[model samples]
Structure formats: C-alpha cells, structure tokens
Target chain A: MKIEHPYLMFLGDAPDELAAKTAIGIKQWRPEWCVAQLSLPGCQADLGLPEMSIAEAKAAGVKTIVLGVANRGGIIGPAWMETLLAAIDAGMDIANGLHTRLSTIPELVQAANAKGVKLFDVRHFDGKLPVGNGEKRPGKRVLAVGTDCSVGKMYTALALDAEMKKRGMKSTFRATGQTGIFIAGEGISVDAVISDFISGAVETIAPANEPDHWDVVEGQGSLFHASFAGVSMGLIHGSQPDAIIVCHEPTRTHMRGLPGYKLPDLKTTMDVNLMHARLTNPDCVVAGFAINTKSLDDAAAKKLLAEVEAEFGLPCVDPVRTGVASIVDKLQEI
Target chain B: MKIEHPYLMFLGDAPDELAAKTAIGIKQWRPEWCVAQLSLPGCQADLGLPEMSIAEAKAAGVKTIVLGVANRGGIIGPAWMETLLAAIDAGMDIANGLHTRLSTIPELVQAANAKGVKLFDVRHFDGKLPVGNGEKRPGKRVLAVGTDCSVGKMYTALALDAEMKKRGMKSTFRATGQTGIFIAGEGISVDAVISDFISGAVETIAPANEPDHWDVVEGQGSLFHASFAGVSMGLIHGSQPDAIIVCHEPTRTHMRGLPGYKLPDLKTTMDVNLMHARLTNPDCVVAGFAINTKSLDDAAAKKLLAEVEAEFGLPCVDPVRTGVASIVDKLQEI
Candidate 1:
C-alpha cells in the first residue's frame, strides 16, 4: 500500500542511532517527506529535525506518522500507544515497519478505523498478486544482487537512482525491504510474501514502464545464504532485469548469522545471479559492482575496487565513498 | 499438525474422478487408514469402498473426515457444511485441504471445539519454525525435483520411499503439497510458507534422523518456472539432500502455466538443481531420474528412458510404469 507523504518520523524510546537507522534512511533519501520528528521520553535517537507533538505535526500538515525506529524485539512499546492513538485521533495515518503488526493491536486498529486513517505495515503485504508470467515487460531494470545480505544492495540502488535523476534519466528506486520501503514511499517487502508469490509480488512492485525508464530494484538475501536464497532467486527471476549490479562486503568471512557458512566469492556470486536471472531475461548483463568498504581503510578500499574492476571489466564503486556515478554511467552503456 | 488416521474420505458431490483425485491419492497410498468413503447426493466419483454416513463412520471407528475434493474455486460449499457439522457432532475431527480454512467456519469450529476434536487445515501452516541453518544433520536424504510443477515429483518420492521400504530400508516420504500431505498424513505446504521461511519449514518437516534413515522429501515447482522457482530453491536448500532424483514429464514443451517459457533440458535442470542444492550439502549428488512417460506407449517409454539414462549416466525410469527399483539401487551407492 502507498504510505502518504509529508510524514512524522517516530523514534519511540529508541536506545541508539542504529535503532532509528530506517528513519535516518528516510531522511537521507526523501528529506521532503520527513517533515518533523516525534519521540517519547528517554528516546536516545534524533534525526536533527524539530521535534513535534501530535497537534503540532497535524498543524504542520503531517499526513502520516512513520514508526521507523525499532527497539528490543521490534515490538510496539506500551509507552508508544498513547502517542499512536493521538496521531490517529488527529487524522494521521500510521506506517510501521516493526515485527508486530499494527492491525494486531485492537486499540490502534479501532482508533485508525474510527478516524478513517490507514495503518501501513511496511513489512507485511496482504494483497492479491498474480503469479509471475515471465512476460517481457517494457522497461530497463537493474537489480542490485549481493554476495550476502546487508551488503549495500539498497544503498547502491538508491545511489544509482539518485545519480540517474541528477543526469535527467528516467529511473526509479524499487524497494524490497523495510528500510528501502521507508526510503521509497511505496514497495512490497518481497521476503514477507508467500513463497509461491515472491516473484509475483516483485512483478507487481516494478511492473512495466516506459521503454527507456529504469527500475533500479533493490535486492534481498544472498543466493548463497541458506536462510533466504529463495527470496533472492524469486527477485532475480521476477525482475527480468536487463542488467544487474553485484553488491559485496569485503571483510565478511562468514555468512551473516550462520557461523559455519562462508560467503561466496564475488565471481561465484555474479555467475550464480546471472544464471537464475537469465531465466526471465535471457540477455541480462552485469552492469557494475557495489562494494561496502566501511570496514576497510581508504587505500585498501581503492585497491580492492580497482582490482575487481580490472578483473571483471566493469565499473566498480562503494556507493557511499564513490557516489555510484561510475555505476550510473555504466548503466547507460547497458 | 499430525492428522489422525482411520479417515472417512469426503467427496462432497464431486463432479468427476479428477475432482476427487486427492481423496483417490489418499486411498491409494494409505488404504488401511481410509476407513470408507462418504459422498453427498450427486457425487459422481467413487473410491470403490463402502459408502458410509456420519453415524456409520463413527460406529466404524473413523476418527477424521477428510474433505479431499475441490469444486470450481476450491471453496467449501455451503451444502457440505451440514454433513461436516454432523461428523463433528459425532466426535470426528475434520482435516481439509481447500482454499477455505476449516477454522474460518465458525459453526464447524464451534462444534469441533465443543466436542474437543481438532480441525486441521492441511494447506495452512500456523506454527513456529526456525530459519534454516544449513547444518549438517545426520541422515540420508533424497529429494525429488521436477522440470515443472505437477510433473510427478510427489509420486516419484512416494515410489522411492515405497521401494526402499520393500527392500527393508529406513525411509519416509515427506510431503510438501496438499495431495502429498493427504498421502503422508502430515506435512507443511512449503509454497504456502512465507518466502523467508520456505527452507526453514522444510527443515522442520524432515529433521535429524538416524544416519542410515532416508527422508524422501517431495519437491515442488521448478527452477525454470518463473512463478515458483523461489519455492523450488527453498526446497532444494532445506532438503540438504545427499542425492536428488530429477523428475520430468518429457511430453511437456513449456514451463507449466507460462506458455511463453520452455522447460529446461534434463541436463540443465540437474545442473541447476545441484548448484542450488550444494549450498546446503556440498556433497550432494544426482541419484537418478524419474520420468513421467504417461503419454508414451510402453516401448516408446522404455526407449526414451534408456536414452535419457545413457545421456546422463544415471538410472532413469518411469515411477508409475516401471517402479523406482533402479533409483533405489542407485541411492544405496550414494
């Protein structure tokens, strides 16, 4: 569902900045939509926006209160209920990306229903989607695949979208995860969809567009990660991309959360991604590479990027350090 | 949840044999557990069993009534509700594999709860399951993967399990779909699971067992099918199969339901299945091939099977016509 814009960023008793990373991401990518911040007592995170109460947010024309910050267990804390109710009473929709569904809370559901405002659970998708048909949709798509999950795929996609816009290119950042959903106003969390409908949901998310337009679809889960490769495979096939950007994190020795599992090398990752992607788009090509060099020094990061680019004969960059200009340029050639 | 046996198969006014195929499957595989058949007025299908009413079934010690037939939209007909209530009133649990959940019918739910009998919605799974860890568990696993959906993966798995048992081997058929669940009496519909947990649900379905024990896990969808490769990938990873049997219906030219897409060749299918399967079990091997030669004459099926065996250097047979004797023999070597 489309979450309304001009939002109030909610950081409800967040313990640290990391807890509010999703809110920060929204501000980073869609600053105009982040009108103001709302926080409860003892909240430690801040978006550097002028804090507002429900009345002030409503008066300021905030249409939705986005519960982007997550605390322990990703639950809606008891301390946040009054604030949520007040926002609902003020005729503001609530969009949440937490483990607990807002619909599961009777009080919140009743308040939102009574006020005729919507509750957007960004992590949950409850719409009827057709099964993917692998039809040749009219559009250029570039999916950011990865060597592992949480390896800068989202950031790379956002950067590419931003750079393309700066160049007056028709491009849209397609979100497939919670943080990405907050960054973009609307997108499905593909991983939360039923297994049978993963590809279908992705197909719905990006759909067909102008022949020259590019849907830079954000990826999820590594093909090598045992926990989530299924989601990755579905995303690859449904995207039917003309090109894919391979994302990687250099310093990770093991797969995230599975100590016994090692991440596949960049070459293996790209090769596997291409193999599955070609099922839907037989001409899918490797557009570029996105590396997360946060753990490396500048020299090391530069050395690694250069080596990878030379070896693969593709543009490579850290979306954060290098701004993905080269990758966006490479996308033009594809 | 374990669906109790000694079931009274309900074919509620099924229009034809195909409409009652799932009930037929249950009777074919678990005949001893099928006490009798119960048909409504206008039912055209028969399982060649004595027809019984709810009172007769209860008197004969039938513990469950399995609604194993489907109408046009897979919905439960209002006409069947009376019979279902009657069964529940007689202390019989209900197990259904339909689009309509038994728990959603307040009347049946109320009756079942009052009678202290359970209602099983086999197509739905509502339990806690951990994410697949891809750990090396002790067991010999053989997974039956297919070229597309409904290409006899379940039949092949069941055949393999039956053959293994006939030869005094420790084997079990693990179901992954509704028909298979009816045959096996218990299973989680992997495709129905959330995308993130497809593999995890499978892992739970076939947990650790004796080193010599075999979990003949039935497969779903295909890696080449755009609509459902996600489910296939998850099944492959979660099986951690020591060996995989490739099932194919040679007559089909296109991937199921997607007329624009052609099925991958057997070699390509095997290679891709192995590539994905290797993530969980590095030592995974192709055990054999199970072909659906239903459309071919006996001689043609035999010749085709021989040719495929020669091409792949693996044992190949039609599970229905020739049985899986050679495949079971091949499994012994692995």
Candidate 2:
C-alpha cells in the first residue's frame, strides 16, 4: 500500500494512446505517488500530468523512475538504453511492468546493480500456479470486470477497496496483472501463467480465507477483447466472486491491443460476463457498474451515466471522477 | 494426412474418465493409424479398443506409440518412465500431445534417439502466433463450438469435414489442440499458446483464403466451462466464423476438468457464443447442433436427438455414429 519513495515515470518513445495508461492510472488512484511526468516531443502535450524534466524529477527526490506505460509487445528499445543507464547512474531505481524482464538484460542489470538500486520487473514471476479447483473461500469475493482491457478493472477494484476500508471494512484488492502487481507488491501475473493454470493462480491469490472480508479482485482483458479472453475467463472462474462490478470505458470504440474489433454494449457485456459467472456459481450477480467516462466532458459524462443507469437499472459512476460509493453500496447489500 | 507407419498408444495410470479421450479420439477418426492399445493394469478394461501388450504392438508393425490421453494439469508422472523407456528400447517411436512435453525429459530423449525413433511432442512449438485479426478469409469458416470441453468440438469438426468431402466439397479440418494436431500432423495447440495470441493462432490455422471451400475449424474449451471460457471466447473471435456448429454431450452432467459445474444448456450456450462472435462478425449464426450421444443406448440417443431438434429447431445428430451430414447440409445452405 506504500510507494516507499517518490517515483518519476519515464514515457520514453511511448505513443499517446498507449502512454496514457500510466498518467491515467496515477490520476485516478495515487496522484500523490507520482510527482511529475517525463515524456518526449509528441506525447508531452497530452500526458495528463504536471510536466517535469529529468533534472526537476531528480531535484524533487524521486527514488525510482517507473517505466509506466506498458508498451505494445513489451519491448524496451535499444534507443532508450542511454536514458535508462543515465537514470540508474543518477542513483534512481527503475520499475518495469513489461512482458520482457529487465533482470534478463545484461546491460541494464549491470547498470542498476552498480548503483545499488532495484530493477522491478513486475510482470516476471518464477512461481507456477496450479489450476483452481473452486476451493471454498473464507470471504465474499467481489471481482471487478470490464468491457475491455485497461478500462479500469484494477482501478475499480482498488477504488472500491479504498472506499470500503474508509468505512473500516476489511477488504483485499487482489492484483491479477503486472501493473496491479506493481501496486500491490505481490501477485501472480495471471497472463504470464500457462493457459491451464490461470484460474488456479487467481484462486490462490484470493483464497476466500479471510472471514467477513471482501476480496476485491482485478480483471484482465475483456470477454469482448479477442486477444486476452482466456485470461479474463480464468480470472472470473478462479476468483469465483459472489458479486461482479462491471467496469466500462464509455469512450472506447474498440478493444485495446485489438483494433477494428468493436466493443460490446453495456447490457450485452454484463449479460455475457454473468452468463459465464453463473456457470460456476449460479447465485453470482452483477451488483453494479463502474463506468470510466474519462474521455467525455463532465456534463456529457453525466448525461451518458444517467442514460446507462436508466437502461440497466444499476448504479453507475466513473470511479475516478466520483468515488465508487454507489457501486460499493450495491456491493455491500449483495 | 499421411500416417507413414502404424503406432501404439500408451495411457499410463490415467484415470478412467481422462483415458477415454485417447480411446474415443482414435476410435472415431484414425483407428487405422492406431495398431493397438497399451495400458497399465487398471485402465485396460475401460480402453474401449482391442488390447495389446508392447510385444504384440511391435510384432504387429506399430511404427509409433502415441500418448493418447492428455492428463489433467498436463503432468507426466515419474512412475510412467519405466514403461515409456521400455517402449523406446523396443524400437517404438513415442508421440505425445500433452502439455508436459517428452522432449523436455532427458531419459525419454536419450532413449528415443538411441532407438532412432522420433519423439512427437504435439503440443510443443517454437513459433509465436499473433492476436487473430478478423481478416477477410477467402473461404467460409464453420467453427465447431461446444457447451463443455470434451463435448466433442474436435470430433464434430472432423466429422463435418469428412462428410463434406464425401459429398465433393473442399473442406479442411483445422485442429486447435494436441490430439487433433497428432491426427492432422500439423496445427496449433491453442490452449498451450499465450493468452494474448490465441485468436491469432486460430486465424493462421483457418485463414479464409480458400475460395468456394469450408474451413472446418476445431473449437477448444467451452463458453460455460468456468476454467477455460477465455479460450472459448478467443477461438470464437479469432476464427471470425461465418457459421457455428454447437456441440454437446447429451448425457454429461458437468464440464470436463471443472467438477460440479453443470453444463450450460444448448440454447443459452448458443446465444452467449453468438453474442460474442457478433462483436466481430455480425453475420455469424449457429448453423446446427452436434450431439455426442455415445453414452446413450440407440433408442435413448435417437430420442434425445429428436428432442434437441424439436427444441432448438436446428439439425441435430451424433456426428460420429450418424455422420455430420445433417450439420454439413445446414452449413452449405448458410
């Protein structure tokens, strides 16, 4: 739950659409954890955070330079090597949440070790998780689902957990992917797991052992997103949540990482998720909706929220702009 | 397409339910490819084929020993090593479709090489597949989807392809898993693939490039099976199928590998699958139903088929016993 020290996030060679992941993630949850944003030319204008140069970030006592945006294909380019080595020599640790491991790269590994700073590759996990056997969990499972990847599944779960703990409820935000793993410090990178063992990994992480506690689990990939659908299904089954919070990014026309694939509607999306969830636990229900209207203006977002609420008869709110109180209320009742 | 030589199958200490996979798979399609069945003491009676000792298989000119059943968790037991090594020493090539590859085991590798016999790890592959883009395939795609794993997705696709070719249609049976890979000689093991690239693998296998033809694509997992629903979704989205053959095992009470998970009914399964498929291809439709009525007696099987046809208003048949002509006819019309 602690950042330990201030961190500067470097969005080196990250495209605008992809680079927003780090800026958006920090804005919604831990704005304080990030002191500034460092981006190159084209992406600098739309980073959605206070802009700062490397010198300014260092002057602000930033301990780690987080590689925030998970680039497509998770590649760390040879062009970025000079900047990375310079940061390490400047006595700052680096945290990466890419599929490629920083530990495996000899040049980066030696540079970080020389400065006595850590290189956290959040996506890298050595432990193998077995397939989930639907073991009896000790607590209520509240899993946050979404219409597509990076639509706020983890943020919704985290936001819901933060809100619940504010009322003195014991809640656990179970991380299922790399960024969530970075935020939580420990988790099975569910996508990194072998196909057969995904559910098992989720079950192990949120084993329902904590009595009266709510395990707010993160979701990955959408039921609609063709790329990571297997990971999504595994998370749903393994977590075995009694209540589901459907997160939707309203402005997303297509699934992330999968262009030309149109997103499913809110109702279809909710029904599809619940239809599968009910397969393992028949009593499973869609408790509420966590909408991400970040792309819409405040007034237009409110209008769209009202429309969705009227259509689905569920409490809907952008968890980032407004707290997830409405969804939390529905969840507690469930 | 060429067997080249005959092969014996080894199902070592595999549980009765799982061992049936090998017995049933070979019995339906490539009975001629298999010379004899080789099992340890316990699984012998339930093999559903003519039994053979190692000596009998070799004398009968069996060219390879195929590991038929894919074990749960894909774990190859240490206890089975003696039997496998003996088979290698006896000059029998070993073919495995399990995720636990024989190529990774030193003992098996050394023994096979010494005997000059090839070891076929069907699930093992070096090439990485990308995410399936809903490309304009040249030929029509008819995917065989199912309500649960082992409900005969692969069997139905194979059966439909056979029937179509018999009727003088250009049909290609594209295998998505290991057993089908062994039978077909080449195909991607979709479940073994990374979660992100499942659809891409399917696209590569069943690309719509064959004009005036049918790609009878094999489906994996189930939309209702809590454990592998993601794989199911990926297959559906990646294939961008023009039509769907919904397969079901009439007498099964639960999904394979997921204990106590009651199978989703045919109509609901069809609706849920189509709902996701339409996210990419709006013209996608459930063409027919492939009922695996193997466990039922003749009268009961016929009665169940009649009931399914009446209920769903689709062509229903046990693709193996009765052939997939009814389903194939429905596909051609679509």
Question: What TM-score goes with each of the models?
Answer: 0.98, 0.80
- Name the candidate that leads on DockQ: 1
Model 1 captures what fraction of native contacts?
0.88
Give the top-scoring candidate (TM-score). 1
Model 1 clashing residue pairs (backbone): none
lDDT of 1 by residue, A46-125 (tens): 99999999999999999999999888986776799989999999999999989789999999999888889999999988
Determine which window of 10 residues in candidate 1 chain B has minimal summed lDDT.
Answer: B70-79
Backbone atom clashes (below 3 Å) for every candidate: 0, 11
Model 2 is docked with a DockQ of 0.43
DockQ per candidate: 0.90, 0.43
Give the residue spans of candidate 1 off by over 4 A: none
Per-residue lDDT tens digits for candidate 2, residues A1-334, read 2224576767776776555575456445666777777776545324466667667778898877777775657778775777788778888888776668889889999988877877877665556667667655568888888888888888888988999999898888888776776566457678766666677778888875666799889888887776677678888888888889888887776778667677777888788788667665677898888888888899998898888889889888888788889888887786
lDDT of 2 by residue, B133-232 (tens): 6655678888888888888788888888889889999888888888787677568777766666777778888875767788888998887776777677
Instruction: Looking at model 2, give its docking quality level.
Output: acceptable
Off by over 4 Å in 2: A1-95, A106-120, A124-126, A257-259, B1-24, B31-65, B69-94, B106-119, B124-126, B257-259
